[model samples]
Target: MKIEIWSDIMCPFCYIGKHNFEQALEKLPFKNEIEVEWKSFQLDPTLDAAQPQNTIEYFKEKKGFPADQASQMIGQVAQMGKGAGIDFNFEKALIINTFTAHKLLHLAKKYGKANEMEEALFKAHFIDGKNVGDIEELVSLAGNLNMDKEETRQTLTSDQFDYEISQDIQEAKNNGISSVPFFVLNGKYAVSGAQPAEVFADALQQTYKETVSPFKDLSKEGGASCDTDGCSA
Candidate 1:
């Protein structure tokens, strides 16, 4: 079975969802056979990198939520984040455009360092309070992954991986994605948000079994599930 996740680098829920999915995959009998693809989705494509604002002010201003509500949401997410081994620095989290970071991921993917860079970016912004949108910080993060730092820096400044990133975002929109942490199980079964490990495990187990083509059940009326081998819906 193949699972594709469309998510933003800065989304707290995406990190949490990833944690849950990993935990779920760990328990599967066919875990080694499953292919996991991490696709990109940017929350703020046009954000100003030069004027990064604190994430708290961002939620309040963008959503019109009161400070107390925003703080409560942050607290809940932070506490959940601890289970995933990520410490979300809500107090210091900054909001910046993730366009460049998304571009960098495509570059990293080419070198088989996408997951490493993804975790590094998450830790940089949420745990270390690093400015993820800053080119310097991005280069430093890529260096930590043992990637060619100078090449990464040049890749960021040039229009190198923009096409792949653009295609990712466009595909997400075309697939009816409206939020981060959208899990496309076999390109059919989608579980949104930061679902728990047991829930994900159950879905994976179900998906693994349903991969067997259902030509035998020709009279079945219900539409093929997202997990079906040749799902048409």
Candidate 2:
């Protein structure tokens, strides 16, 4: 079975959703047969650069949330993340445009390291508080993943993979998606938000059963068939 996940690196729920999905996969009997593809979805495509404000400040100043509300919201999300094994440090996170980071994901997909790339990017932003929008930081991240750092830097500097990023966004739009951590299973089942691990596991199991069923006695049908006492053979 194939699963396509549309998420932005900046989305806290996306990180948590990833963990939930992984936990679900661990419980699946056919986990080894499942394939996951990561797609790009930017929270702010028009954002040009990294804002000077941290997450709390961005929520208060840019999003117009009250200071106390912003802190409470982030704190709630951080607590949720902790349950999923994520340690979010929103106070140090930088609000940056993720277009280039999405592009790097496309590049990583080509080399079959998309999962690694996604995990690294999420950790950098929410945990390590690295500027994901910066070319230097991105290149360094690529190097740490054993990818070609110079090649990644050149790709980020240029307009490479720009169309792929746009296409991913357009695909999300065509699917009527306006949120991150959206999951599509077998091009049919759609799961929104950071659902529970059991929900994901059930979806996977249902889709797998639909895709491939165990052997059944087709000869014991309602139609005319051969039998020891019948001439309707």
RMSD (CA, Å), candidate 1 to true, equals 6.7
Tens-place lDDT per residue, model 2, 1-233, is 89999999999999999999999999877999998999999887766575545887778767899989999999999999989999999988988899988888888887889999999999999999999999899999899888998899899999999998889999999999999899999997999999989999899998888789745555755666677787573
lDDT of each: 0.84, 0.90
Misplaced by over 4 Å in model 1 are 212-233
TM-score of candidate 2 on Cα atoms, chains taken together: 0.92
Error in Å for residue 224 of model 1: 27
- Collision pairs in model 2: none
Model 1: lDDT equals 0.84
Top candidate, metric TM-score: 2
